[model samples]
Target: MTFFRAFCIERSAPATREALCGRFLSLDETALDAGDVLIRVECSSVNFKDALAATGRGKVVRRFPCVGGIDLAGTVLRSAAPRFAPGEKVIATGYELGVAHHGGYAERALLPGGWLLPLPASLSSQESMAIGTAGLTAAMAITRMEENGLKPERGPVLVTGASGGVGTLAIDMLAGRGYEVVALTAKAEQADWLRGLGASRVMLRSELPLDAFKPLDKGIWAGVIDNLGGATLAWALSTSKPTGVVASIGLAADSHLSASMMPFVLRGVSLLGIDSVYAGFSVRERAWARLAADLRPRHLASIMRIIPFEALPQVFGEFIAARATGRTVVQIARSGETEDMT
Candidate 1:
């Protein structure tokens, strides 16, 4: 195709304070950024970062007029890179996608082959996008924590931002691995749903005085997969057991961290910052393999929703408002193209 539709995020001219503008535009194939692989995008997923960039809510977009979807799965159409060839199913995420570089939100994406991975055989395009960057981050976090001596029998693992995509997937993965998964969320209403996703206990954020963090609270958590930063992160650290591993994934709440060093110095708690973007190929491959096998979320069908590509603009608000749940996969393949990617 010479031209295709893409939801592009553009900057609104030169302003004192730059504002991002996002819209659907028909873009020429030549307009795409240079890359070795050309992919016919079948599916993409909306992430918290996508919402921030598309809506201009957060300072996420590093470059202007970029197509915005951090995670994409599709069939490759052309390749200059020796590792990939035409007609192979593949997935791409992170590494400047949706922010600095043109990303998935288009019918076709031209990206460096090094930024892509063979789509796991067990995961279809739809299912892969359903997992997307969020699931990948969760899997990476779990893998990192486990490598740091976190085990199912260590103790309970706390997942902050529990109603969101990463938190939900982490809960499912942790519980499936026989760990006691405790979900911490502001939405008390989703307690039962979180439980269904394998959260052994649901802790409401309102119950905790996040700002009133003690230097050392009763050591409760053996591991923590923290999505929200700021006070929530501080509380998690302060309450962690000796040598507990905390994987800091996202800064949805606030970026600044203010807490006593008691958790780290006194108890030897380990805080691991998960950088899914710019992660080396070997690390991602190992995580993806586990994602397809044991770390794969068991309640995916129950928590995921497939939406038509046109409906993409409508859901950004839900994410910006912190009302989004689980995962939302965008079906990007046009009509007449195979919709049953699974």
Candidate 2:
């Protein structure tokens, strides 16, 4: 039996007040959850949800002792599913990964083939992981908005949580497509960086009068990609132009929405719920196709940082504290070992 390293999230012994604890463990194939495709995980990336799950900060993990990564890119070592073959380069994100299933924090992963997609040829495994769940959500938001008649010429698009992964990637993608992007962030220091990511302007979160959300404010944004929920989302809806689109991707701040329907009823504003997890195969495919093409972030190198797999345990707090920016890719396999499974 071969042994491999995995980061597992498990229940703390009954005496401990904390409900969950995460740790590194050595395990064999027998320890992994049952699935059709076996992969040698080359790379994985940290997402806000992954941080919440690993740290017991949010109700994210559904199964105890599950591996702790939501996104992975790898080469298939074996596959019983007819849709996949051994040696194929693939990527998997969302679904039950890192929540209810053994996930990508391990050197090896066993997952249903339905959860995987052939990695885009233009992207390396590290690149795919850098994009990960955040990039996928951003792409879905853009594609959905475009399909619903959003155009670059309509008006500026506002991306909340602008220093985070989804916001940074969305700014790059929107700018690449010739849209004027206004980034909303609490970090004033990141203004120049956000602008370099193609944002035309940076609006500090503190600058927005979130406490004073009006039923209908002067229409400003033609579209809004909101990562933070609660008051920021309400503000986005209240100030959107007629026929505007708002894609809600995350609830990092708060989940509750206390807003008026004046924007929807009078301005005809559309609020789209972007659910990356459990999105249908067709939706995932379409999003990835766009990601590989026009929707790919132009500032990927500037937006991503690579860390060794062993360092994963120490980094979750950065996310929990909202101190991390852009993307952090975990290098799982040793250099030059991703394709050489021997």
Candidate 3:
């Protein structure tokens, strides 16, 4: 309404030097970045990328003085595109937002019209942020698995990084699809929580490699939805059944893979890399629709942690240190003027 509050990382000192500061600032409509549509952001989420941008840990933000949030949902306050109008609820994520562009860590956000998605009928702004890009990746992994001939009737499905956002959501989605899902995580304390998300069995990291993996060990898993790459991915590949599909999404552990081609050639294993960013509108829409329908979480509140804007810095630290799990939704605009919003 008046001055907007935003959490941003601004460039400072010598231009050649890469000094940055993260803090809160007051801004007006003029300060909002330019885009085809202006939205009053109701909620933005704390994704790993957002945490990296906010904390300046990784090379996630290419521009200086940019807001730090990768996912946002809100009511459009103004629109230049024919596809959207004032007072329409929309969601924006991926593409260049929060990276090359000023993103959604503010009370108001200006986003390219093409990046906006009408909120699925089944989800609210809060729920959309809870799902965010992580859910999209999980949904994409599932869709890709089915396309690659992964049927529930075949056997059990394995989910790596079972405590993380994508892993948790994938477990829920895979179990919801009638597949027997086994979760793999290092934290044994969260076993109950993982099971609540639909994991039939939870295995700690030591349980894996299960006595050293060869080129192809056993055909235990019909499908694998993996978030951690590197050795974890290699293990999944080596243990997967013949003609098994493994969807690789995130690389929180390590980026490089040290695996032989024996699994690929001998087992006919297929490794699909899931990219949520820059996914086409049709694919994104289908993913959200599946999210609203079958992939909808039975324990949404259980999988999400909501914090006010003031808690961003702490949460960002938790994310970077790998101390946080599940999804975290940031309440940006607490008092959105959405009474008349359609």
Candidate 4:
């Protein structure tokens, strides 16, 4: 039997107050659930949700003894599914990965073919991880807004949580498309970094006046890609131009929405729900194609930090504390090894 590295978390079997702890462990191939495609993981990236699952901060993983990485770019080692062949470069995200199933934190991954997307020609495995789930969500937000008649000439787009992965990438993508981007962040220190990613202006979260918001305010935003929910999201809806689309992708602020229909009914604003996880296969393909094309980040080197897999345990806290900048890619296996599996 062959053994591979896997980061696993387990709680007490009888259930106690003892916190769940994750550690590096060697796992057999058969230990992973049955799936159509077997992949030699070239790399994986950390997401905020991965931290929640690995650290047990949130009930992200519904099962125990699970690996915690929600996104991976790899080369297929074997395939029982007709859509893929061995040695094919691929990417997988969302779905049951890292939750109900063993995930990309391992050197190997087994997944249903339905969950796989061929890596775009424009992006290498490292670049894909640098984007990961967060980037995918950002791209989806843009695509949804564009399909609903958003144009670069409309006006400026607002992105909340501008220093985080989604916000940074969204700013880059929107700005790359010639749209003026307004980045909202609490990290004043990162204002220059946000602007460097193409934010035309940076607004501090503290300055938003969350406590004193009207149902409708100035129609400053042509569109809003909101990573912060609660007051920020409500504020986005209230202040967007009439017929504007607001893509709500994150709930880091607060999930509850305490607002009236004045924004939707009177202002004619549309709130788009962008769900990268379990998005239809067509939608996934379109988003990846866009990422490879117009939405590919020109400043990927500035947005990525590559680390070895062993560092995952310590880095989860960075995401939990919202201290993580841009994206962190985990090198699980070298490219040569990923492409040539014995």
- Find the candidate with the highest lDDT and give its number: 2
Q: Candidate 4 has what TM-score?
A: 0.96
Clashing residue pairs in candidate 2, if any? none
TM-score of each: 0.95, 0.96, 0.94, 0.96
Candidate 2, position 338, lDDT = 38
Compose the digit string of candidate 3's lDDT tens values, residues 218-319.
Answer: 678889988888888888889888899999998988898888798899889999988999999999999999999988877779999999888776777677
Model 2 spans with C-alpha error above 4 angstroms: 13-20, 338-342
Across residues 108-141, which tens digit of lDDT does each residue of candidate 2 receive? Answer: 9999989999999999998898899999999999
lDDT of 4 by residue, 1-342 (tens): 768999887753313222335789999998998799999898999988887777776677888888878999988988999999987899999998998999999988999999999998878999999998999999999999999889999999999999989999999999999999999998999999989999999999999878888889888898999988998898888899989999999998898888768889997899999999989999999989989999998788999999998877778878878888898999999445524453
lDDT of 1 by residue, 1-342 (tens): 478889999875423122336888999888999899999999999998998888776678998889999999999888899998888999999999999889999998999999999999999998898888999999999999999999998899999999999999999999999999999999989999999999989999999987576889999999999999999999999999999999999999899998889999999999999999889999999999999999988999987999999999888878888889999999998867742221
Question: RMSD for each model, in Å, please?
Answer: 3.0, 2.1, 3.1, 2.3
- Count clashing pairs, candidate 3: 0
The candidate with the higher TM-score, 3 or 4, is 4
**lDDT over C-alpha atoms for residue 82 of model 4:** 97
In order, candidate lDDTs are: 0.91, 0.91, 0.85, 0.88
